[model samples]
Target: MSHNAASEPDHHPVSTAENWWVFRGPADLPPPPSWRGIAGPAGTPVAQEYLLSPEDVAVVNTALHLRRPLLVTGRPGTGKSSLAHAVAKDLGLGEVLRWPVNSRSTLEDALCRYDAVGRLREVSLERERRSPRGASGRLRYRSRGRHSDIGDFLRLGPLGTALAARDRPRVLLIDELDKADIDLPNDLLVVLEEAQFEIPELARLPEDQQNVEVLVTGSRERVPVSRGTVTCDNFPVVVMTSNGERDFPPAFLRRCVRLDLQDPGEEKLRDIVRLHLGDDALAEAEDLVQDFLQRAATQTLATDQLLAAVHLRITGADLSRDQLINTVMRRLDEAFPA
Candidate 1:
């Protein structure tokens, strides 16, 4: 599962090129300048150069061809979330639309959000301006604006905007789906299948005025929606990750192409350490990697743990190597040991 073998560069099929083109950004709108800085705080494009096993590459390609959401199940810190970022960067899909899942998450939260309180305040202020009595005397009430444009109160959430984007398919990351409510995954079935969602506030508008422009993720500008409904020309490359916290409904699973990420082997771990730390740290990193392998035998040992410990050592942390291992190389399950 080397990078070259996994990427399958030699097999230049027409479908592969077409799939690659689907992720290219629109010609009219250049990607925001902020992306250069935001994508990689440390000079790397977020997820662009991330290593993928052969199985992962095959599964991703399949998902791209079928236009289905890719559901990734793996241990925590196995780069599940990073995979979304990597795909977006490699494909030139601008910024990733990330919707983090939690116990209270709902399908509505991922679609669009309405600011009722802000709308009400606008109404109240408009009413006050139109009142008969003023400090001086009664005068003709002049309307500045129509209460407030409904678009002002509506903002598309990550998923909604991704679907609405008229350009290339956006990369949407539904992080940690296992942490969400049981009903959340099941609720996503229609949205995932139909590739669209409706906003009630916009739908209620007159037919003549239903094309409202609203803010969404990615661009600083807003996009127009017809009749308050958002439909995608190209379905988003959705990546939903799970840490094995719970089971998803079978119906939901059937719609998605699933992949399980394998834990990195010692050589892969060495490569990762070399990527983050420098070549100078390899000799020391090898020793620490061995210590981490031992901890992994009994419990979860994320790649980040090894990176952190090595970083501290290389930076001349005042502690001994043994002390650093003891403090930073502990098992991930130590806090909640059974």
Candidate 2:
């Protein structure tokens, strides 16, 4: 439905099946209320709780306002990644840029690659073949070293995308930074501090296009990033997550706003299940989910296992309880063998 500020009250709350829509401002065009605390689909509304506390919200808000990176630490399945998406949605920004970290990851892995050398070779070969001597001229072709046009192929990486965003700040999710190598985080400190990165390839390009975009993430890998060395002058919002594996360098910790995540309570879980699964299966799924969680708590079952059981319990054939349990167990066993 269209919202006009002139027609509607300054704050009019409309209830829908999923969530409430709040409108504010002028008649011609009214800006939708920020979805900071609200939960639902990207633009559509859905009923979901902000499981984070007020203090946590303040920390996040401060990070966003100042464009500083906010580091979030918590156990697995605590919705750390989801927060990035939420921030983008709340600000009416589009999709988020996600950078998944791994052990072998490097700065080059996250930045653009220049293929100028390859292109130059192809062009030289083509010219030789079309010369007066035809294929025979190919033998006379000089072996001039390939020139690198770093600017042309210097495409933006996840971090680059975040820093270069001009229209609106884009949400960036750097998942599992701990897995990355030592130099990766150190290399990132330069861009994170300056809010600008120079692509060696692009440096030769026109001044306007020489800069690269950037956003970075880190985990409990404990790589050292020295202080007073690099600072984010542009201030892009940064979010980091840790699985409580190890402590980060003190210097890195001092620069960030950290927050912990708590497991969802029954109410919040119910809301999440309903939001994703629907109302009809909420009751049955909750029971199965709780049982799965109980088992998981004692062992080290992945979150996907619990979700699988819930799915089977709600959507599987109308079998006896024992049969259903057997099906779930079999699936879990296949997914995670002892």
Candidate 3:
């Protein structure tokens, strides 16, 4: 029943009956045929066969083993978010819990929400329907479920799921920490330190059943959660991404292990293209990628722009380098404005 790198087939048909909610047996979720080619120490890949480096592998492995948050800073299209998926896949961790941060995001957004207002409205309507008749045939006020507490509808959020999952370590992707407000990161300090967060609605439940555990992610918005700062005690594996838009506060930098991602070399890009496409397509696309990379080096384009060109070359009607270069340059202008 165990999956090994060599024995598994490259492609297997998933059952039509199988769905995300319906649990698949172990036999159903076999390893990919080329698993061995991608695996490195600690179950992650040494390189993504193209983009990663020895330093990148080392940093990722250390974070995975030590269970510390690994902060990754890079320009856009440097593959920050993809690293989370690669780690999860390597470790046999199921799916990643992605918490995309933006302005106006709050701790409550990360934690569970108590539908206090909704519950009150529901109770009010129920009470009005059941009230006894008063003078002039008007109904007198009598409460039905008004006494009911709002805590019943409180549900756990991403952070709650991570803390509670003791069986297997979950991969939490906090993408674009810079986009969030200042208070968001500060609010996360408590949960990261304790490895447990509280849902006020849980007070309605017995003390034992009220708390939810989960992993958390923050964007660079620098939300202030509390006056006093907190640090992780459990050493939960945290992955934070930055697009290098702004400089972070000194105090915040002190809390994390930071790594900067460099652009993938030509050989690595070739490997990646081959892995995703085939050898024939890779040969045709390599020169175009090199040109794209040259532009990227000059700060004239982004990695995504390069990827788009490769994708178009592989799938487009004409696989010529000229066609690809023209397509990519056009996309670059649309994606990145002057």
Who wins the TM-score comparison?
1
Global CA lDDT of candidate 1, please?
0.76
> Once model 3 is optimally superposed onto the true structure by TM-score, how far is the C-alpha of residue 149 displaced, in angstroms?
7.4
Candidate 1 per-residue lDDT, tens place, 47-79, comes to 324777677899998998998899999997788
Off by over 4 Å in 1: 1-48, 131-147, 336-338
User: How many steric overlaps are in each model, in order?
Assistant: 1, 12, 22
In angstroms, give how far residue 125 of model 1 lies from its true place. Answer: 1.2
Decide which is better by TM-score, 1 or 3: 1
State residue 71's C-alpha deviation in candidate 1, in Å. 0.7
Tell me how candidate 2 scores on lDDT: 0.54
For candidate 2, lDDT tens digit of each residue in 1-338? 11111121122232332222123422232233322233434433431223455666887888877666677776666678777766665566656677888887777656434466765776676577446565644445444665333233335566765665554666677787767776666576656766655455444545554343322322111111122112222344567666666666767666667777766556656554554444655676666667655665554344434444554445443445566456653333245556
| TM-score on alpha carbons, each prediction | 0.82, 0.64, 0.67
lDDT of each prediction vs. the true structure? 0.76, 0.54, 0.58
> Which RMSD does model 3 reach against the true structure?
10.7
Clashing residue pairs, backbone N/CA/C < 3 A, model 1: 47-86
